[model samples]
Target: MPQSYVKRILNARIYDLAVETPLEDMPLISDRTKNNVIIKREDLQPVFSFKVRGAYNCLLQLTDEQRKGGVIAASAGNHAQGLALSAKHLGVNATIVMPRTTPMIKVEAVKRRGAKVVLHGDTYDEASEHAHSLVEEKGMTYIPPYDHPDVIAGQGTVAMELLRQHSGPIDAVFIPVGGGGLCAGMAAYIKYVRPEVKVYAVEPEDAACLKLAMDRKRRAVLPQVGIFADGVAVAQIGKETYRVLKDTIDGVITCSADEMCAAIKDIFEDTRSIAEPAGALSLAGLKKYVAENGVEGQTLVTINSGANTNFDRLRYISEQTEIGEQREAIFAVTIPEEPGSYKKFCSLLGKRSITEFNYRYADNRDAHIFVGMQILPGGNDRQEIVEKLQKHGYDVVDMTDNDIAKLHIRHMVGGHAPQVENEIVYRFEFPERPGALLQFLTKLAGRWNISMFHYRNHGSAYGRVLVGMQVPSKERKQLEALLSELNYGYSDETDNPAYQYFLS
Candidate 1:
């Protein structure tokens, strides 16, 4: 029988470690969306993540024998930090098995909390298997990140705070889903107490275990997952969490890497708090929701899940924010490769600030001008610029929506591979992480001969992978079908002029 989690959630002892973070109103986002945008500042928690609530509560409920043996966990990052802090608080020994490629900042954080930090394999799969081995060998109690009942109940405390703090009408609460713990917990409690207040789950499109599970109506395992948003990059939703989530969660909102960057930028501008990629997911979902649907004046809330981002990762986030927010528009312009062609194109731009311009003449007849122009904030001028350029006899292709242009070509202008035969070029968006390239190869490598491959790390929620595969004209549809089944955002660049002139 399933226990009443609402009752258990209210009874959980977490305040000893967790803080009742303030609910802040986002003025800029509210004005932009024509709605009341509020954020739950969980990033301000002691461990800089909401994981502390679950960790402390779970540890407190453990049997005396289990506590004596200490605890062990396999975490991508944030859970380990939470457990470490919880263990320190309880004066118990804790051992954390973390992914080897986890950012140095997170690894250092676990160590600072006095936990035995074990850097295992590169992915969560590898780290998980290793953690189980440690539990057996060291006689430690294995603490499941989101699967256990105690952990779920502990996380539900967030809803308790939310309902108690705010008396106004809440249209929805956006939560970031990793293993579904937070979503499951909050959704269960909120739906029980206030069914009208929808609990929306936010996830990275590349690593959306809960979304896939919901679509299938069963728990599904992801062979490959993106790690750009490291904190919530779980391969599969937890059993207990999934069981609760399948019934209670109102909707799932998926966000792209670029959109997440935009959300992070929004948070930084408003609060000067640098939330991690996963931390900024809820706002990304909120913005995505506002853009896609015609909803306004409703109050929405999203949690700043954590602030454990790496220092160097800021470069990736900062670069993509302009495009993500539509503050800058990029385009590929085709012009006559004559002496005055550049001047005429500049005139068509009409005194707009040029963020980037890369002009390379492939031949004497035509030249490809890669350019970026600053767009007015909160204004829709992308299509207007395209129409204005077309009116002036300039052929322009809006590259703002093109992943290859935004990720690779804009940064590195001419790297044309020479003389490839029967090659079909396709640009794919894969989860950005350590083994993503290898995972792509593992899926479709042996069947086709990869003629040319170019990958650019955009530091967004996803990695940009451009692969050129040699396939006969007769078998082109077969390749298309395979790619369609893969369900990744991809485009055929085989007939692109840039490829014809420079690479192919």
Candidate 2:
């Protein structure tokens, strides 16, 4: 036996996948990396993900009779869609078992591809177990999501594309690991073709099964997986993928929900395409690795493997971006419960925009009044800001340093102020672009006088604004009710404590 039969099978699997999928050199992202950073755009493949490569390769190795019986697969989302679509194209019946918690959008996508969709348990592992049982009961081919050699070899096609697309030797390749099929396959191929190149496997912190497995020198299982990055929320690394990957990978890393969100935002801004959180894991890992290890001057490649995402997930991503990047600060200010107190507090604010204002008359306390403000991001002097407020006899609670603000208030926020009889509080979700604020003000015109206004522009698609306008009592009802017609929301906050503090 010159070479083992298993080794030959792995080689053949990789060969088959390379012929079917196209590779693209992502140039815009390359310039930023400064090391001829190329992307294996597995996201652009036939199923809009690299999963098809592995699923199809695995199917091709299946016997014709088994193919006729059809295939069953369990996926967080993408793999189900991939296997179902590929199986349909190959004229094989596909039954996809997905978690009940799986987004309707992904379920519809699988159904649209002509696959039988079965909503099973609450998590992928449960759905996968159900599919495995079906394999024995129905004599259908059970397509392992990431553990089989065929699947790994199919995933290796991304490495082949990168090697062909880029001119120089790759210093490192970053791959996102859910069950580690993609990373294992990519690492195996890279090791075989270019052994010197570093292979990095990235996983979400909540689902770092592969990294934990590597550290323990064995497959590690997580009690529960994180659903934030639903695409890679594997509670256990696949056994076969682990065997292929254990020694080939250089290191394993973890990323937070925020880091993933920031990476998704970066990739979107760079390419105008939204990547699923798992797809952005490679980039997130690269950034974390580079910053931590101080690694530089090496050509890097990250596999942007999938783009299927729930549009609603973008809201969570946007909410986490600022905290992950440390670009926004939230604070609570205690001003005097007296006349001209609001004016003094405003004067203390130097070149800062208010993103939030939560003030309530907790008690008839004269010494303190609670107010929350989200300061503009970057280069903030927390001490100076606090000192200035204190100089004006206002106590400052830097909620930026408070856990409550970090966890709750930062995300569940809208501009809030006290309600006034003649004043109306309107919430405007304007585009987060320069001059957008001015356009909103211009739209208001001379009909309403600005009593109080608050706006802060985070790097979000839309900015939230709370404007307090003093309108005649006759016009107040009409003004408050007219915003809905203009596509904005108005709440009569005249009775709100925060509003009364600033208004009266």
Best by lDDT: 1
Deviating ranges (above 4 Å) for candidate 1: 1-3, 376-380, 416-504
Candidate 1: give the clashing pairs.
257-461
Model 2 C-alpha lDDT per residue in residues 207-248, reported as the tens digit of each score: 999878878888767865666676787778898888878878
Report the C-alpha displacement of residue 238, candidate 1, in angstroms. Answer: 1.7
The Cα RMSD in angstroms, rounded to one decimal, for candidate 2 relative to the true structure is: 12.2
TM-score, per-candidate, Cα-based: 0.85, 0.72
lDDT of 1 by residue, 209-278 (tens): 9999999999999877776787788889998888898889888999888889999999987788999999
